[model samples]
Target: MQRQFFRYNAKSFPKCYRELATSSSIFLIFTAAIAGCTNSSLATKQQPATTQLFSPQTHLASQPPRCQTAQLSVSKVSTNAGAGNVAVIYAFTNKGSSPCNLYGYPGFALLDSKDRPLKGVKVIRSQGTYFSKQQSPRQVTLAPNGQASFEIAYNQVRDVGQSCPTSEKIQITPPNAYHHFTLPEQINPCTGQVRVTSVQPGIIQ
Candidate 1:
């Protein structure tokens, strides 16, 4: 004789057990949804940074206006020479009502009496010379009617016959300025080279 076991049936399961299984399925789906939303939020935070285009006008707008060529007037204040070298100090006065600054060196060229540039003449920017003290390039502020100065040195030795080349006039373009001005001067350079200093507080002595 054999003994038998009981048969399985879903309808015979407890009511609380069925309700608990359905609740677990719903909880899993809700957790998955919350995880997806968190991942999306993190991805948004990891996006690339924003980029901006370079703007010259916007950059310049934040700075003070440059010293205009028209607002400056240059005058030779003193002159000295030694060892076949000559140096002259020029003062630049601010004619405008507003204050401004001069930076770096001035572009200059020796010109003949006929208003033409001389040949082989070169201008080199320098900090100092034997007759002048060395000065670094810096912002030289000028108040209304205030002044700054610079130094120009050149050789006056013999070149071809009696002297090198000479000029009675020079064209000067101030640093950071577009327009140029002319000045009457007497210069005799045998080496065809000129060394100039940056604009400073006062005339070099």
Candidate 2:
């Protein structure tokens, strides 16, 4: 029953909502990631400009601190729907004076009118969606008043005798941040599944 409204590497962005164990498997994955980064660096000499532009670690010392929820704000910019699926694009504008960075996927939770989490809903991060083809998560630098965006997409199918659960608001926690804020938007996803893309530069269509 899987269709391609959104796509992601399960290896890179697993079920992020759950807690991970501090085990050898985690250590091995980290080791592999570092190896991959090192290998990419070897090719950097061949593509100096490309490497400098996309590689966040090239000037890691100069990169701004991670964007905290206190330094930014989110808005539901626009939405697209078709072929029984819908995608919503949201932007996080840097409201603080200092520049900051955002990388990877934001955490999301749908809450009912009473502020309890909606049951039976699943949310996972994706690398791309039907509306946009984007790269894997990279550091998105946000200068003062600048923005980075991501998309939340889901299927909207209903069965014959039951109605989808109603959500009265949306909760968003920026990547690597512990706290969250809520948006007063209603949602009703019948399939109980949702996909979110990693944060990227500017507003993505």
**lDDT per prediction?**
0.86, 0.87
Candidate 1 lDDT, 85-152, residue by residue in tens: 99988888999998888888987889999999887788888999869778899988788998888889
Instruction: Give the per-residue lDDT of model 2 (tens digit) for 1-205.
Output: 8876766545665555323544567888999999999999888856545443577676886769999999999999999998888899999999999999998999999999889999989887789876778669999999999999999988887879978877899999999999888999877888898889999999895
Cα RMSD, each candidate: 6.8, 33.9
Candidate 1, 41: how far from true, in Å?
A: 15
Assess candidate 1 and give its lDDT: 0.86
Candidate 2 residue 62 Cα shift, in angstroms, is 1.8
